[model samples]
Target: MTVKMTRLRNGIVIVLLIEFVLALLGYIFISSKTSLVLATYIFIKNIIMLALIFYASSLINENNISVSEVLNDEAKNAFIFGGLGLIKYDKNRNISWTSDLFTEMKINIVGKKLLEWQPLLASLFEDDDIKVVDINSRKFEVYNSKESRMLYLKDVSDYIEISKEFEDQQICVAYITVDNYDESIEQADEQTAASIQSTSRQVILDWAKDNGVVLKRYKSDGYIAVFNERTYRKQVEDKFKILDIFKEQAEQLGQVMTLSIGIGRGSNILRELDELAFSALSLAYSRGGDQATVKSNDEPIRYFGGNSESYEKSNMIRARVIAQTLAGIIKKSDNVLIMGHKQSDFDSFGASIAMYAMCKAYGKKTYIIIDYDSLEEKTKTVATNLCDDERYRGVFISPLRAQELNMSNTLLVIVDNHKPSLAIDSNILDIVSNKVVIDHHRRGEEFVELPLLTYLEPAASSTVELIVELFEYQKEEICVTEREATIMYTGMLIDTNYFRTRVGTRTFQAAAKLKELQANVGEAYKYLEDDYDTTLTKLSITQTAYRYGEGILIAFGKLDKIYSRTLLAKAGNELLGISGVKAVFIVGKTGKEEISISARSTRDINVQLIMEKLGGGGHFSMAACQLEMEDVTRAINLLEEAVNMYLDERKSE
Candidate 1:
């Protein structure tokens, strides 16, 4: 109540108190007739005063509710009772019954309450001599003292949510085998090794049996399991610690097991399932082994524990293997077709030519697919010079012609890229059953799988080095034309920025070999030169570069008809020249078809992680993706946030 209203109520009570005091005093001392009249007047006035106080307190207390505020609408509805004073609250008979001189009618407000304290009518009486009664069956309680009158408020609320029902669904099957099991065992004594293997096998069998899963023993070293969702959940939550279990059990056995798990979900198509399972196993091994990974229909790809130490690959062995692989490809396929990523750059195109020359050495019919007019004039001049020669007449074909020549007898050789979607002629991929993917880029999500062979070394500067390594391993004096050698060298120089990035012992060796093959260094350097306008364009765009966390971002407002991915790929490397930047992202306006985004990172950051958020993924260091967004500004904003988030997370860690 307002202070004014409270004051008015206080004034009326005080007046009543004074009148009662005067009348009581007169009744004891004055004449009997006068005293009786005065007592009756005070009694009526006291009754009227009590009624007014009740009206005021009841109205204020009811309007101001504390309990209703605590209870939600759903809870409030459940509290309303019928008007018969027989309010039922479940099976409990805890309600207290009482009676008063006034009617005992019960009221329930079926809405939220906002009262902070309960009101008492006794507080309205100004006279300390006033009395009140609380009547209970078989008992009489009197409120004769003002100190006993008090009110208190408290909040009470609790709720439970309904859970969704679970259905019986098919479960995916996953199996694990330690990659270095044999080596770890061989290091142990005969008795110790035997005991370790036996104990480990028993532990796996017992765990599977207790979970009601069926296990099939494969080669005494690999065990396959079958399970559904209920079983799988138990396995992840319970059996993920199986490695720790094995560690404890085999402590005295003198050996440890490093596990690699492979999982596949679908059952009807065993071939596809087998391929997927193998891929999962490969991924697990790549992750340094020793973990569990679950695969199902929901995940088109596999899952593995990331950040594993990769297996060390020897350069000589890699080169030898690739040479043999190339020879086998020539032996199996009748024709060899080579191509690169779209809007082929000097490196991509040069790598294709190198692969084509290698194929030609095997007396195999080879076709180099390219868009001659789309390249820079220097690149176009070089390609035109090579194509005009009679020896290269049947070798150079347009993308359309390459698409038409698709056949099962042909081998599709994809260089500088592993992503089929970014290929020059993806249709060629669909037509040729046999394929070889040689790339320097890190593996991405949409990389072409099911290849006859694939050599993906992210550490290499360019695919040209891959071809050079293959040629070196062959040890045969295969004649490479001046133009082919220069093209390959130009591509290597472009990707490596003149031996600046990821160029190691092998890169230098390959460069030496290319130079020995009479590659014109001056001509290749000329191919990298750009006009004054293009240089100004690059510099102008770079001025907008800004720091985000440890990374840098820049957007190209204007770019020519050339492919933006190639341009940003160049720009991303350029941005990395700025100090303190571990990663860089370049966004540019391409044609109406797509917005180009290129991301590059040093060892401390993974640009692919940011790109993957936009439905694109690439290697840990350098990656490019096309945003389908029509608005370039919106795409850039989203990319900026992504880059910042990635760097922030890295910093926090």
Candidate 2:
């Protein structure tokens, strides 16, 4: 209610009380006749006063004018006693009557529109107390009176500043570890190893000092750092430059060094912070290291500094341990079911068959799950050849048949892909209690949550190479059949682009072992040969290729015929063979609703990262993704945009 209306109502009540008191005094002191006359006069006065109050209320309601304005200073004392400040505003929200307190505060509100006070109003609405500066600055508890169109503010800045300071002092914890420390030191002489370790420690300490973080080395290769919320935000804003600094220092020592950093923040409990840090650390390592990962109590994982190539670790000992473990798992199970990603390629099919052969050697019944409808031509050809042989009858089964045969003791092994959504039969994974994942792709956001065992090596050329290593370490003497050797050889051949890209010492070793087993290279080549029509189609597609960004080529068009993934990959690889082309991206439709992209690079660009942005992943040099987009042009545009964005980011780095 307006101050004027409230005061008018109080005045009417006071007048009535005064009338009653006078009537009582007259009746007690005067004669009967004179008292009656005084009473009649009092009744008439009361009626007139009530009529005047009602008329005044109607006028105030119609004009929105406070009674204090109509009778200025009549209720000023009441307003002061109630600790209320009143200011009248015209229809334009221009101030008219400004209180003395506002004037004393040097708040020149009169004759100014309400819009001019938005800054003060915004601050007032955003917090319990707001700082206002006219000629002098102070904080206030703000209140708004809509009926009177007035603002009231009471000072309260000191308390807010103290609360903000306390919030800024919250603690955050981080853990850092030198990835590949063992391999780096083992390859160097004792003196050089000592130098590397010393340099690494000094670099970390210097970084901590520069960032105002308290550091403590808890292990030879691990350190824990504590930071305040303010410093943590600064670190995040800088994108954790310490990771890049460590990489540079390690390279200076003639060693490849990478750090995996995990940070925990936004939690009051130390135990929760520790758990978050551990989770972040695991995520950083799983994404191939050389990065800083942060996980607050409620936020998803955030990453930085993963631009460098992943270092290949020596996995001889680890491979041996895994081989022994897998053998044990296989022996315990009644039957083994092996499958790979949907639309199985050479790498996926070869890895499955290799596992099948290994399980058979242990005298365990094994089934190779094959979805024939989705199989590529080369994979189908291989499957047919293996089925015709007398030794491999009844080895192949459909997804439905596999489900029926699935038992609690059965072991499920996934190869060439780790994402459950991309599995040939994702349902089987849910039904089986025992599951193992083996893939060579860099870990993505979508992956199997918990597997009995995981053999993920992003540095390896292909999943088949890892399987070949396992074969060498298996306790039982297993003979590699010619078919088995050929398929494995073919897998290596395709994934490495005929050993021209992503070829490492271990990759060559796996190939040499396969050759030693008399794997027929000519047969593998025969399966990869394209028909005349396919060759022409690839050539036509190649003609559509155009330079995109720096050293990047993009070939985009709809296919004249539905070409298999093998042919598309060949097209991309052929584009990379052109001089001055560092990378090639081929985008086209293989089916009505499926658009496939085959990315190839020549050690200059990381195509895997590009494909990963588009929901696919593979080796740094070779990667591919399939989108549900039906428009070939739209898919091409998205691919080009992704490639350009990657190139720009690298340039900035």
Candidate 3:
């Protein structure tokens, strides 16, 4: 006999036995109520009922017919009636009893709880609305009753499969581009050039064919592909291994060749999907490329693989163009206000001051918005000096005052940061109609929307470098006070970590311009010197840090005391230079209700992506994040998990 026949035979025997026991119990109860003498016959009555049921079962077993010959799949053709099965359990979810329909359905519920055999049913027991689940290759609609401690399961596989079929056929669009094709191809020889061109094409074509995507190449470096939702889901399940394919191929080519892939789905409109794909691709480039960014209709954009730092652009044309546009916006606005990230450091403060002078050169009323209460000890000195200067009196204002000023045609120039949430006063952004962003950090998903001009150069050492270049293209000449030039030079010094970090040709050129303006190097260095207490904190971090696997170090400060963001960042930077430590993550309490992390890495690691996973972003070498947790130990646990997860993903590739 087949397995189904055995199951059917067992189920029949069990059901007949249950019925026989129940009937004997009813007969025994009636006899006991009649007379004491009849109670003695109760045991005999039960044996007779059992014997009768066994004889009937044996007669059925003697027949030659099997269950397959007796019934169709699901026993649908054999049964004239079908009923929903009822199950009851305690609050602990242990199985107490099940109705007869469960036996007919071939479910092995004997001596088992809901979760023991039906782990998927664990969540459905929450007493929520009716939910659908799959059990034994059949779909079920589950309805729960907490008051009665009962659950109702009805098979609905036919309707569920129809809905699933429709869902799997939804359209998905992907836009792909060779990230460094223009630059890489210009330098390659014939053999290598052919590999970058045709080999790159074959890599994508093969993957697309494997994934059931219709591939079309529109440009030498660009392509468009289409696939269904089922295929797209499988790609996500595999963590978008196309990124790993590109990484392996680039290794063989011995050059910087990578791809940016943007996929858009969850919508039927083809035009909307195309637009989304394009937008996602642009975002991927802004975030330093070498990745796949998937954007769904109403969902957050998901990122995969950005293990490499963005390559620097060699041209200054884009910088000059942005400078001209910025100058025009400055000339048109009635009044301009400059702001930076919270607790503005020398880089942020210097960029804002330079912008202040640039706007002032346009002969427009401009003020640098700052909050004195939040200023660092070093920035307070810079602010005090500017106030004492004859040229800068009444030039600096608070964010509150900037917002209260006449609101018409006002220009907002945010420096050193693009994300509004990171601003000193995010609310100030809402009142200003025209805005400009000057930043050197890699772009993240959050951005200042529809700015009048955005000058973002992640490759540049500092925002001040971009500002100094803009000075060459401006229509008006900006005169430098020795104090202003010193601030600008200090911004460059701080961001580049005193010229130890990445420094390029334009970085030096910008530094040369500052030197010519009589920016005293001695004065710039004075602002970077930390107090004795801060020095102690920075030293403690490295001493306390413990090594994590794969050249990562983890450290945290006392939970009872609050540490400055600058302190944590400086500690991370210093720890990164130590031998055998490729990346350093320093965690500490920044506020009574908040914990913060400062992550720094060498060229071998990408700390920015790690921080982004923890709700923060910055350059590949440096980044930070703030969490709402008060316990430093708990925060360290989360950081370890993120590091392990990132490392594990790379290992898998």
Return whichever of 1 and 2 wins on lDDT.
2
Model 2 lDDT at residue 251: 85
Task: Report the lDDT tens digits of candidate 2 across residue range 494-521.
Answer: 8888888777789989999999888999
Weakest 10 consecutive residues, lDDT, candidate 1? 155-164
lDDT of 3 at 291: 83
C-alpha lDDT of all candidate models, in order: 0.65, 0.82, 0.82
Expressed as tens digits, the lDDT of each residue in 1-653 for candidate 1 is 65786787888888888888888888888859878887988789798877979697768756655445545543433322211111111122121222221133232322212121112323423553422222222111223222432212111111111111132245456666754456557677888778767887888888787878778878657877766656766555554556556555765565545456777665546566566566676555533355455545565653323222222233366668778877877768888888887777777888888887778778788888887756645667777888888778878788888877747699889998877887877777877778898887655567686899988766577889988888865644567888788888998887776676666677888889999989999988887786787676677666667666535656555543334455566677788877778777777766675787888776556666678767666555666677875676787788878877655544433
List the candidate numbers ranked by lDDT, top first.
3, 2, 1
Among all windows of ten consecutive residues in candidate 2, which has the lowest summed lDDT? 127-136
**Angstrom error at residue 56, model 2:** 31
483-533 per-residue lDDT for model 3 (tens digits): 888999998997887887757788899999999999999989988888897
**Each model's TM-score?**
0.59, 0.79, 0.81
**Cα lDDT of model 2 overall?**
0.82
